[model samples]
Target: MLKNKKLAVIGVGKLGEALISGLLKRNAVEASDVTGSVAHEPSISRVKERLNINVTLDNCEAIKGKDVILLAVKPQNMDRVLKEISSSVKPDQLVISVAASVTTSFVEERLPDGIPVVRAMPNTPSVINAGMAGLCAGANASEDHKSMAEAIFKCVGETVFVDESLMDGVTALSASGPAYLYVVIESLAEAGVKLGISRETSTLLAAQTMLGSAKMILDSKQHPAMLKDMVTTPAGCTIDGLMELEEGKLRVTLIKAVVKAAERARELVNTQTSKFSK
Candidate 1:
């Protein structure tokens, strides 16, 4: 889908860098085919050096003649960036937004009429080529547009399509999920430290275990509960640990955390939409 496609990335920040780097690493697009733009002059050189692509300060210049434009700007800055490039973005080109809580309709309204927009929520794990992205297409986007957008994200990891109404929940779950998992890893490492394990070794053990466990679920294609049961045996230490986790309400706490985050994301979307509507 990306063959011979010229790409533009606005707000070449961390997520932007990770995405562009993933594309280049996967040979999805070449350094010469991508243009990146940053808000500051210093970032121009930084992004250029890192991605080996043309970097510009002008969003309009960066997007000119590009086949796909990826917006990696902050949620609050999305409106400003969209308006800045609205005149230049063509209907033939696809625009993909990774700004959290921003909907495809939110992007479509700010662009030229009938321009295709794909809203995506990708996580930090994309830095390691193991990200998860949730995508939803605007009214103007065709299946081809969606596929092209999916190809870009697949370079980093996996992609899924859902209705726009579920996107904020996707943002809260997958995009915001890494931080939650990190807390779990940290707590596991702390338990190791309390048991006289060195902090460094404990952290490595905890992180690797998490990675392995995740791989098991993916590779086995079994329910997580089934996997958990497999790890528990009659009078096993694993069951004792699971008991402590249940007693501490870890599962419920996690469920509540995701729900709360989703609620906040919805509020932000409502506020942004209200502001634009006004």
Candidate 2:
């Protein structure tokens, strides 16, 4: 779907670089078809050396004539970047923003009228082509624009459409999820070390187990509770381990963690809106 399209990524930071790398590595878009803008001259050289693409410090110059413009700037910097390029962004171009806590309305309000905007929240795993993204379209966005946004993210990993109101939940559950899972993995690895396992082997075991479990959830299409039941045989060791987790209130703790994170996400959105309000 993205073939023959020129993409300009604003703020070629880590996530921007990851998307560009994924696009090139997957043959979704050729390196020559992509241009990236960074804030400073030092970053221009960094992007050029790392991605071998055309790099510029001028946001307006970088986005000129581009078919799709990915706004990968930090949320705190979104207003400044949008104001910088708003004049250059044409109505025909698709604008996709990956800024956390920044909404489609927030972006659309900054750009020219009828400029389609898509808000996407993608995690760090996108760097490895195993990410998950939650997408939503602004009022002016058309079906084709939505598809283009999906195609861009699908190059890196999975994409799911959700209502704009639920974006904060998605941000907390998936975008911030990797960090929480990493903590779980670390704790599991420490348990292995306590059980006399080598640190390297323990980490591999913990990480691989988490990966396989997640795959099973996705591939089997069975309720996670059902899968847990399948693993818990009568009076088995797995049941004993599950009991320990229950005693520790692990489920409730995780639920509260996500809830708190979502609350924080909403707060940040309001903060950004206030900071950028006209």
Candidate 3:
């Protein structure tokens, strides 16, 4: 769907670079069809060398005549970048923002009327094409715009559409989830090490187990509890581990973690909006 489209990524940071790489690798968009902008002259060379695409420090110049403009700058930088490119962004073009905590309404407020805006929250795993993304459209975004936005993310990983109101939850869950899962893997690896396993082997065991378990959940489409039962016998060692986890309140702790992160995401969104409002 994005084959012939000219896309300008306003910030060629890690996430932006990952999306560009995925698009090119997936043949969704050619290297020549994409342009990227960075904040510094040094970064211009780095992005150009890394992605082999045109890179510039001028956001307006990068976005001019682009069919899809992706705002991948930091949330705090969103307002300034939007203003810089506002005049160049035509109504016929699509604007997609991957800036965390920056709402579609906030993006629309800065651009001309009827410029379609799609807000996406993609996780770090997108760098490896195993990411999950949640997307929502602004008032002016049409179904076609939504599909194009989905196509961009799908190049990197999976995509799901959610009501805009649920975007903060998505941010707290999938976008921030990798860090939490990394902690779990690290802890499990530490446990293996404590049990006399070598560190490297322990990490491999922990990470691969987690990967396999996740795949089971996805492929079987069964309740995770059922799958857990499949591994956990009545008097097995797995049940003992489960008991310890329950005693440690692991489940509730994870639940609270996601809830707290969502709350913080909402606060950050309000802060970004208020900062830009001024």
> Each model's TM-score?
0.97, 0.98, 0.98
Could you tell me the TM-score of candidate 2? 0.98
The sequence of per-residue lDDT tens digits that candidate 3 reaches over residues 1-278 is 88799999999999999999999999898899899999998998799888999998989989888999999999989999888888888998999999999999899989988899999999989999999999999999999999999999999999999999999999999999999999999999999999999999999999999999999999999999999899998888999999999999999999999999999999998887898778
Best candidate (score: lDDT) = 2
Can you tell me which runs of candidate 2 are displaced by over 4 Å? Answer: none
Q: Is candidate 1 or candidate 2 better by lDDT?
A: 2
Query: Which candidate model has the greater TM-score, 1 or 3?
Result: 3
What lDDT is reached at residue 162 by model 1?
96
How many clashing residue pairs appear in each of the predictions shown? 0, 0, 0
Q: Over 4 Å off in model 1, which ranges?
A: 276-278
Tens digits of per-residue lDDT for model 1 on 1-278?
79799999999999999999999999999899999999999998899788899999999999999999999988888888989999898888899999888888888888889998898999999999999999999999999999999999999999999999998889889999999999999999999999999999999999999999999999999999999999899798999999999999999999999999999999998897777555
Residue 272 shift from truth in candidate 1, angstroms: 2.8
Clashing pairs in 1: none
